[model samples]
Target: MMKNYITKEVLPFEGERRDLANVAREMFNRKMTNVAGGNISVKVTPDENFSYDEVIYEKGHDYLLMTPTFMSEAWYAKLNPSQILVIDLKNGKKLSGEGRLTREINMHEEAYKANPKIHVVYHSHALNCMFWATLGQDMPNLTEVTSVNVPLGKIKCLPYRTACTKELADLVYEELIKLGDKSEQNIFLLNSHGVLITDTDLHSATEVLETVEWNADIAYKQAIFKKLGIIENYQSCGNSLTI
Candidate 1:
């Protein structure tokens, strides 16, 4: 019954299928998810054949598809597309029963509404992002790498709210708008929560999250080495080369 429901109305595309699997694997391998910690979703394009006002482009088709919650990231990596829930955004209906739609579905909805260009949303409690959040530090654009990706814009922080509350949704919506005309690649730190990463597609979205963690890891390690007074002279280590 669960398998039948999940596979019922999903659109089959090898690219999207592979993307989903890759994201799941990467998240697990990187320990982005400890046990069952994060969720990933991809938005489906509305069908061109359907009229603008039509509700059902096709009975079985879904506007969004997501992985099941509570499954270990490693376990989720092995799940078939049929094991994920297919959600109809038009009416907030779930066409599949493999698992209930995540309560944070509103987060994805709000992000999509704010930025039509975003096709993927990833929410994870990454250690580095979380460390900054816990310290209540604004994620600084200190280095070229951090500035290039996260940039110099403010890292919007949403206050603690119930995971699925209307307040939480509203906060995220407002923050995105507050980002204003700046670069759309800003990363938002959810206070006492997790990181909300959105992007043009699943692959890019995953990359953005990876970059954030990478920067954080680098910063943390550098701070530790500095405390130990172990800084090495990079100029002395190698011969200079003209570019």
Candidate 2:
């Protein structure tokens, strides 16, 4: 059942679609995620043509503008605005687009429903971040930049659950609910998987992702330095050195 809803009706949020594509390219180029690693999405209120699912999408929830499935493997970084899928978040139907919706759609929906203020959900399998994920440990606040920039207190790692499953989505939803309404940002590491980020907008989400990845890189280096017994020697030398 290959479903494609190429529509003549003007797609609702053309500007948002363009931004999504551009951001996708930027992230790909930056190596924030690999070709087949992750997904991004934004919550949006649909136009008059669509109606909210009163039961599932309570409080006027509507649609999602998200990166389509296979935008990574089949399409790579060459995403176009036309490829961004418009999805009915309430009922999980394709509203308009030539591409199929991502299977992780449920993850984004649960994130949005858990907190109405969160407008973006960005997930990625960045290499440095995956280092910590592989170990199934929380990424400690490693860098001064992360401490100042990333609003989330601690980077929690969730237990491994199969990807694109309702169980995974529910797990994320429960974590988001725990963050409470006032929280502005969230970053989670899926055990032996990747990172999930939520924020008020794409800009904030991507910014936090970049900073967190950088922090992860620094964390790796810090571990190496500590193991090599460089920290104590470097500290001792710093007291006598003049520059």
Candidate 3:
């Protein structure tokens, strides 16, 4: 069920709300996500608006400021600050904003539970990423920028699972636990679904998403060359992508 919190006629975290909306616009403009559905969230500290004892929000210091569900189908790139919703990280209840909560809320919540340091959780239906996702293959690190920015190595493609199901969310959480802060491997490609990127901040997360998508495009071209025999044993520049 969806829950709503009174903001005492005040909207808290105005700056964060604006930033999140801006990122959503940028993502839509870049085609990182589409009307098919995707979600972005940032862990935040609540203000006085959460001071009530009746609300579940006082249970935790952190909350999730997330893009609304159906954002793409309804508003697409025109998302505004008022559309971003606040969720209580501890109880998973909608705390503020008028927008409906995303069905993938569990994906972001479980991820935060797996690693408290993860501040941003970005899921997208990028065209190239979706290509690899539909193909059910992991995205190899063909671009040097990906190798440098995503040190955790190749973008893994998890087995297929129905979207918005606990099974899918749990699977993502398990993978995150396995990674466990050992490296920068924070990207996951959901089989037949989309891409998931996590990071300590929004900028870094979005930057890595762009880099990975670019690599995915390159991988697609590489596959075409292989099948067409255009390059006759074509191989990547093998570090030529480096400066």
Candidate 4:
């Protein structure tokens, strides 16, 4: 069941809307997500007049706003308030707004439920983690960034399920719970899918996601070097592996 804390209302964000645009830009620049590959959302508290029913209102209601489906991150960041999809949290119904919501919307909701402290959720498929996940290899606790940011915990791998299916949502929820309080550890390697990152705010979450990709990239490059035996004493790179 979905949690109750996801009430609907016009969220008064702490930063300028342009900040969100910059975040999107940076993610694309860092290669965390491609044009239409990833999604980002932030939880906002509703205003005083926002009733539960008002929060639950369907797509046609007055307050619901969302970004267009499959739009490039660059294009998505340029969206106006009217261009965003707004809906009541009580029901999946669209209260008002014309934009189409992504099927992975439930993923965001599940993250919000798992940790109310998490205000931002980022979903992406980067090269490093994707390569490791495809090989069915577990991500090692590598650098200080990975250790302090992502931490050492079980990086749950979900089976190949169709995107946006209830089955996928349930599995993600289950994996998150299995992670316990460590869910904040950033970077979940979905078997054949991608990665999910949650943070107390968007900036931190974006940073963590970027770090996960960087670590994975470094590991991939180092592995190639080791296999070739190009250089000895590669252990100095801060790999968790011991010679």
User: Which candidate has the highest TM-score of all?
Assistant: 3
lDDT of each: 0.64, 0.78, 0.81, 0.61
* Residue-pair clash count for candidate 4: 18
Model 3, 157-198: lDDT tens digits are 999999999999999999999998842338899999999888
Kindly indicate the candidate among 1 and 3 with the higher TM-score.
3
lDDT of 4 by residue, 37-59 (tens): 67766655544333343434222
> For model 2, how does the per-residue alpha-carbon lDDT over 1-243 read when each residue is reduced to its tens digit?
732333324445678988998999899889998977589998877332332222122234467888888877887757877788877777788766678877888888888889888889998989899999999888766555566545566878998889999999999999889889644588899888799998888988888889899878876776677669676321111242110
Winner by lDDT between candidate 2 and candidate 1: 2
How would the candidate models be sorted by lDDT, starting from the highest?
Answer: 3, 2, 1, 4
**Predicted candidate 1 versus true structure: per-residue lDDT over 1-243, tens digit per residue:** 322112323344334655676777678678775664677888776343342222334533447777777645447456665556667766778765356577788887887777766677778888887877676565533344555544544555567766777888887778777665442455777777778877667777777777777766665565566567675311111332111
Best-matching candidate per lDDT: 3
Which of the two candidates, 1 or 3, achieves a greater lDDT against the reference? Answer: 3
Structural similarity to truth (TM-score) of each candidate: 0.74, 0.84, 0.87, 0.75
Clashes of each: 0, 0, 0, 18
Candidate 2 similarity to native, TM-score: 0.84
Question: Candidate 3 clashing pairs?
Answer: none
